[model samples]
Target: MAKNNRTLLLIIFLLGIFIGALDTGIVSPARTVIASQLSISSSSSVWIVTIYTLAYAVSMPIAGKFSDRYGKKKVFTLSIALFGIGSLLCGVSNYAGSFSFLLAARVIQALGGGGIMPVATAYIGESFPIEKRGSALGLVGAIYGVSTTLGPTVGSALLNLVGNSNWGVLFLINVPICIGVIITALIVKDEGIVKEPKKMDVLGSIIVTLLILALMYALTNLQFHDFKNSIASTKVWPYLLAFIILLPIFIIVERKSLDPILNLKYFTNREIALTLLISFITGAGMMGIVFVPQFGENALKLKTGSGGYLVTLMAIFSGISAPLGGRLVDKYSPKLVLSMGFASTLIGSSTLAFIVAKNPSFISLLIGLAFIGLGMGFCMGTPLNYLMQTNVDPSETASAQSTLSLIRSIGVAISPNILIGFISEAGKNISPKLMTILPKVTIPGSNTAVSMTQGGSSSISPDQLAALQNADVTTITDVLKQFSGSMIDKFSPMLKQQLQNSKLPKGVTADTLVAQWKSDYLAQIDAIRSSIENMFQSTLNEGFAKLFIGAAAIALLGLIFTLLLSRKTKPVSSN
Candidate 1:
């Protein structure tokens, strides 16, 4: 390939990754609007993301096998076309206001989107010489990292610029880009690396797909709030049982198949197996990156959207470190580079778990984030892909990359439930604490300080008070804020009625007493609101601290896997 052709190919690959990853998060900001317009419950609307993840994970190995067996260029082109068609359908679903249509369209979109990364990666691994491979693959990894991290921010910017009515533009905008990529992909000459072909392992593919789908389905449905019950429920256990039953069946099928979709040898090779394990741990650690915004809101009490800016800051470091990490891999052994990466993550997550989480501050958070960004840049991309590419045969390069991605996706999929379970369990006392506050709150504006529990004397009715006590931790702050306002509104009318029935003293007018009462009442309500907010914030802080602690544990596990890698770098094979 000419230099210009490689550059164009790289550009096309980057664009594919960007659009696909961008869509992964782009729907999040608009989820509520989508739900309202489609008349779906907020909880049900999560399926849009859930279904895409499941499809994306399932398609990875199949796509990789297709690229390896057929050709990268052809599969790349087909994948882009599928993605484009899916985007079109998604846009149409928005117009039609059909949630089911949108979900089906998302599955098509994910099938294409999932294929792009590994296939593009196989191209880079095969196309580039060993010396340049790290840099090229690292750059690809950086784009993927940055794109996924920035997805929500970009979505928000688009939503703000175009407004909610134009939400479909998010999906529609991909059509032109996909068409352009497909055209370029068609024009690019396939490298035509040949190997003796065998029959496609259709059964192996089916079993693996079913196996992954069942496992992911179970993980996605695990309700963090009701963890114990949810695990025992039909939503989780049935799929889990399916996965367990299918695992041995998949192994048996792959073992007998001459040309398996996933080469069983990769698992048998100790180095590759360790590398895959490390990749899984790395994916779990990367979950910290995803939750950074929520962590900011919970721990630091940052404004709603401002947390994304912190992610942008981390992305800048991640983007820089990716190429730098790749360069380091080219210089030193991968073991050394990987060890350094995991250590950085361990330090970063520990800082968050212990120091910043305990005493939330901007400066402390920045220190922790910087280390995490550096760690993610190092571990997530170049090292893992480089190992997979080098370990497997050229014919299996795409399959190898896909297998790596599939395992990592499982880690990414599972970590949230585990981390969130910790947070949820820690904050279970939030409602009880809130109930204590409600009963004890005394309104000072009354002739005698009145208890909030005194229904007839209080502006807040008993039913409304009970509702506040039952509020979920996620929405308690907003619920309390609204409750405060409604209480004040109710107080004004109630006080006005009281004044008409009361006898006034000589110097004081009923109007003056009413005004004073309103003033005092507002002050009291504001104080009460502040106290409730503080309690909620405190609970969140405790929850997030545990979340970060769990993340740190994952990083530590990655470090252990890093230690399990071959101490010496193997010379690149010239196959």
Candidate 2:
């Protein structure tokens, strides 16, 4: 193949990846808006992302097999067309105000989007000579990184410019890009060797798709319903059972089949299996991209359009690091490069966890994101080097990569759902703690006051005097005990300042002034309690911070797998 043609093909591949990446990033910032417009809860609207990932995971292996069976050109072009059509349908669904249609459209988009990556990867793996393949894949990874980084910013900008009410523009933006990809793809000469027609793994595909759907459905349901009380309450148990039963059956069928959608033999390779595991773990950690925008808006209190900027930092660093990582893979060992990448990710995630868990400042968050991006770039490129080099057969490259992609997608799909469950549970736990600290008081005019003030000879009733004394002493003591010493220290100066500014009636006695101050202090405590209870955003911030820690832990676990890569593994030849 001519170098010029290869360049053109690479360009087209990058564009395809860009569109897919763009769609993925674009949706995150607009999620709250989309939920409101559709009259759905925020938790439910996450299906907008979950369904796409599930569908993408299910479709990748099938698309890869189809590409191997037919030709890359045919499958690639078809995938782009489906994506465009899905985008159109999404736009139409938005216009029609139908959430069901929107979900259905996303499934269609996933069907096409899933094919674009694996097939493009297979094409490059086959077309490029071994010496250059690493760099080629690196470039592909870099493009993907840039697209992901830019997706949120672009989406946010579009949302801001067009307004959230027109959220469909995010989906619609893909149409023209897809058309361009289709046109560019047509110009690339198909030069790869075509394989003979083999039996399609229709049964395996169906079983695999069902398995993914069932598992994702079950996992997602955890956010909306309880799993322990009623197993059959929301189809969660049934779906989980379906997934459990299908697993062994799918394995048996795949091992016995002539053309398995996912060849079981690949898992026999320790390096490949471990690489796939690492991908899954890494995918889970990568949920930072999906949730960080919300965290920024809800936690950091950033403007709606600016929430994605933090992720953009991660993306930018990833893009910068990808090509460099690829070069390191070519020059040194993939194991070394991959380990370094994992370390970077661990550092990034830990930093983010620390910042979020403590006092999160925007600058500190950006620094954490930068580390994450750098880590992502290295992790993304190095794993492909290991997978392609160690376990994949040249002819079955697409299928192998797709299998890895499918598993990784599953990891990504489950992470947000699980993390969301954690966040919701955290909120539930914290709400009670907040309630316990609420002020309990009895004012002077109340019945409780009548008994204590009986001996008073003033205009105020004896009961009222007693109640005022109870409120000023017992209630205040209890409220003060709830706060830490440091908090009380902080509270005193502010209270004093407020009291100093307060006006008193002329000729009031010192005793009366003291009573007035007590009343004002109790009122202030009540106000603070009310504000805390009403501010659900604070609970959300706490939940997000906890999830960030979880993500960091997952990434740290993935780093262990990177260390386990076999030193003796070598690149498989395409001969």
Candidate 3:
């Protein structure tokens, strides 16, 4: 193929991957709009994103294996067509006001999208000269980072511009892009077929599908807020158990198959196994970015939509680092580049855990995020792909890349369940801790003081006390404010009763004492409110601090794994 033709093909492939990744997260901001328009519950509407992810993950290995068996060009164009059609159906489903149909359409969209990243990555691995491969794959990482980062923001912008009723436009917009890519793809010269294409691994494919489906279904059902209880629930455990049972069966079946969906032999190589282990850790670390906005909301007290801008900051850094990391990979070795990436990740995650989480300063947050973004750009993109591509047989490039993607996704899937548990556990402690710190109110012109904790003569009403006792991190601030107001209300009548029953202090008139009492009460209430707010905020800071620590641990593991990789990779021959 001519160099110009290859460049065009790379552009076309990048576009395909860009749109695919965009749709993965773009639907997030518009889920409520979609649910309200379709008359579904918010929880039910989540299935729109869930189903798509489920289908996308499940289809990955199959798509990569298919690309390997068929030709990358043929599979790539067809995948685009499927995605375009799926997008069209998704738009129409919105118009028709059928939630079920919309979910079905999303499944189709994901199936197509599942093929894109791995296959395009495989194509680049095969077609690009080894020297240029890192740069190209780095661009892939950069594009993916930018798209996923922008997905929610772009979705929100689109919804605001088009109005909520025109939400279908999000899906419909993919049609033209898909068409352009497909047309360009078809025009590109055909990459020659494999000389002897292995027979389809039908049995292995079925088992792999069942295994992933079982696993993802269980993972998706887990409620991060109630991690322990949720994991124990029927919604999570049974499917998880099924996944465990099916995993060995799938591996056993794959081992016996003449052409396995995932070639088991690859695991025998220590380098490949280590690369994948590092990739899994990298994926877990990547989830820290996903929760950055949530971290902002809890620790920094940032408004909801503002978190996207914080994520955008990280994405920008990742984008810059990706191409830079690629060039470095070309200049030195993937091992060196990967080590640098993991080291940056360790620094970033540790900063977030110890500094940003405690201080909740935007500048510190930015510093933490920048390092993580650099780490992600290095670890997630070219170096890993380059490593995998070089280690694998050329014929199995797509399959190998797909396996890498699938494993990383599983890590992404699992990290939230564990990391969010740290936050949730902290939240559970707020109510008990708040009870011990509940303020005591003192009446003016009298020595009498009433603890909010006591049942009799307390300022807090029964309902307000209950609210305080049950308050979690999210509701604690509002509950405190409401209770503070209630305390004042209840105290006004109590003060009047006390003043009526008891004589004023010597030379102090009733009017004078009343005024003094009012002044003293307000001061006390202000101090109490400030104290309670600080405690609640501190507890939340602890929760988020733990979340970052968990991420740091993953990044640290990634850094450690990079040490095990050989200093120099054995370069794969272009010919």
Of the candidates shown, which would achieve the greatest lDDT relative to the real structure? 3
Model 3, span 1-575: residue lDDT tens: 88888888989899998998888778888999999999999889879987887888889999988888888888888888999999999999978999989989999998999999999988986787788778878898888877877788788889889999999999999999999998888788866435256677899988888889888889877877676899899989999999989888888888787789988866778888898888888877887777787776656665557678878888888899888888888889899888888889889988988998777787888899899888888887788889999888788788888999988888888887778777678766776677677655676655677665455425456787677655544556567656655655655666767676787667876556666655565555556765666687788778888888888888778888899999878844322
The residue-by-residue lDDT of candidate 2 on 57-128, one tens digit each, is 778989988888888778988999999999999988777898999999999999999999888877876776
* Model 2: lDDT of residue 193: 52
All candidates: TM-score: 0.89, 0.79, 0.86
Q: Determine the backbone clash count of candidate 3.
A: 0
* Candidate 3 local Cα displacement, residue 169, angstroms: 2.9
RMSD of 2: 9.4
| Candidate 1 vs 3: which has more TM-score | 1
Q: Rank the models by TM-score, top first.
A: 1, 3, 2
Candidate 2's C-alpha runs over 4 A off are 38-46, 223-233, 294-306, 429-545, 573-575
Tens-place lDDT per residue, model 1, 81-176, is 999999999989888989999999999999998898888888877788887788888887788878877888888888899888778888998999
- Model 2 residue 529 distance off true place after TM-score fit, in angstroms: 11
Per-candidate clashes come to 0, 6, 0
Which ten-residue region of model 1 has the weakest summed lDDT?
438-447
